[model samples]
Target: MRPIWVWLKGPLPAVPWPHSESRPDVDLTPEHVVVVGASLAGLRAVEAARRLGFPGRLTLVGDEEHLPYDRPPLSKEYLGDLPGVAPMLATAEDLRELDVELLLGAPAEALDLTARSLLIGGESVAYDRLLIATGATPRRLPGSEGLSGVCTLRGLSDAIRIRAAFDAGARVVVIGAGFIGSELASSARARGLDVTIVEALTTPLVRAVGAGAGAALSALHERNGTELLCGVGVEGLEQQRGAVTGVRLADGRLLPADLVIVGIGVVPATGWLAGSGLELENGIVVDETLRATADVWAAGDVARWMSPDFETLLRLEHWTNAAEMGAHAMKNLLDPEAAEPYRHIPYFWSDWYGHRIQFAGVPTGEPEVVTGSWTSDEFAALYHDGDRVVGALTLDRRGDIMKYRAMIGRRTSRREALAFAASRRQPIVAAAG
Candidate 1:
């Protein structure tokens, strides 16, 4: 078998070998490994465990009746004119080959850490090892419950319903200008529907990418013929005959709409985990190795684990982070004695107005445009906290963003980042638009 090298903080160990194949030097395999949440992360965890030669019983439990499916496209292509079935992460045959038991439809009701069991559908399932990857649920608009033409996109069923509204040529009002909301607005406009975005912040994505970059990104809406209302709060939903008719603004204006997509945010799915004796802050508080407690682990959006590299706690809700965390957490679970800290630089990409926007690392300090001009709509910006490059954002510079991502991981200095940008042979703008 090919050797797997583990990266440590300092110099490499003398005997460099696959940690999974070499560590512990004793049997640590569990009889039954039960994973809660059959989404991307949970599924990946099961696959990873089997690949690491754990010939044990594995079970995947999910609240949704359908098998695990990809979610990124739910707000993009899935809502477009030619909507296709939600893409599955694993097929029935795939799971069969993995030799795993599957439980669908019933959500995990509670977790009994002391008893080492999970309660699902009024039944207790015992397990020697447990992994929680329950993911998250979308936050809803206040007073919009039970109203027709109101929706929040989080799953396949939500996408199918929203797609029907778009097909009917509904005038859409998207609340919040975050990634999900922005993507929904983009798809609405692509379908030739009148779209308007309402953002409470003065600038959209200000919290995620800072003011200047957020403003630059918000401009894409206007350029694509969509109206973007910023610095405005939603008072409530205007309804007629139990159907949403418009959104009343705090400033005494009502934006007429036939459909309203609430993309405010999502909270971690921890209600079922209440009193589970696990530390639950914004998410399930896990250590650097994603261990919540002895014999228990958490991953994906539900996990708020410490980042050894950044020296802080982070809970990421992105496709790449979820997929990576699943495999890492499982490997760590299998080899508890030799578990390693998960040092990852957050990365995500989005499609808007025919432009692919990608960002890596945590956005900190002022953004310095290093390549191309914002006017050209092809640029890369570096973010620095003191002398260390902490983050990078790019608009239509796909090939160059990963280079900056690597730099962020290495904690590249500002001078070094600038020099690398200069080597690109492209004019570097001094300020981001």
Candidate 2:
């Protein structure tokens, strides 16, 4: 059937359709829509499809038994003593209202694109359309398996165990000084636990927001009484009677710890899609429209798609990107012919020792502090590539971060960004070389 494409009203920037000839013969009105991975992206896809008046038999599949819950809080708020309640993405009644067949604890085993079926827990489910949002799995430390007191914060269960350890006054050693690792250290310090962070790079988050900003932000750890060890590699985990006791550094240093949190990073959860005829690189390779194959669409951390704005392929593991990409992928799935290219300006925020660190766009170089100095707690900096303002970083400047985000989206020049920052009446610092 000829698909009926409905163009939603919005002020989205138009870009050239790069996959006009590769557009799939999709059934806009499918009989069944199956979404794999019931996390944020998958849940949002299900919700968006139902909200858009899709009257198909909808199924949401998840490996975890629990319903979709907020993951960002797992490393921060949920790990604290006052974890109010589980940050559930949807309630039972909400799912019932949407007529969703929720399949929990049954992970998708494999995909049969030829038969248009999914194998899950020894059962085959047929579908006319599919959305893969399996997300990513936390990378584990080699030779540390089967050891107690070693944990990675990816879900609720992990958070609960870590919180229990914190309550018991465990000495914490966090590996990798990324967002999750940094937040874990912050929470550990807040609980009055002895905490130390070990990062392999010369400066934590140097790859994300450039060396200058990363070094500046890493200072928050030292300011909060947490030991920050950079440029050190972990040899292995020291174990005592099948429980982790400390981290053994490659430089013959043993950092004692009762609990170890590994926040290194995550790998795309595309193992099940291996040999499934799907293009897989570091993740499930999708086009600008988030399409994998003829009728299969991928989103969230599992899908790496082309970014029309940057004219490159991006695979973001942030919550904002997952949530936004989920909804966008659903819209494109519903209206294939008029599918809009996802041109998201990546944004992420991290809380460390009562400081809110927010960054927007892609960091191309060392940030130029346009307003406020690096010594001060409250400041806004702009990152530029030549003349174009490619990114912005702020510490506790919550009110002004969005302005820079918009500036990055509009491809605003560095001069204009600096002028905008100067208009705030704050003393402007000289631009970085």
TM-score of each: 0.92, 0.91
The models' CA-based lDDT, in order, is 0.87, 0.85
Candidate 1 TM-score over all chains jointly: 0.92
lDDT (10s digit) by residue, model 2, range 252-334: 99999899999899999999988999999999999999998889999999999999877788899889999999999988887
CA RMSD of all predictions: 7.3, 7.1
- Candidate 1 backbone clash number: 0
Cα RMSD of predicted structure 2: 7.1
**Per-residue lDDT for 262-363 in model 1, tens only?**
999999999999998999999999999999999799999999999987888999999999999999999998778878998799999999978999999998
* Range of the 10 consecutive residues with the lowest summed lDDT in candidate 1: 1-10
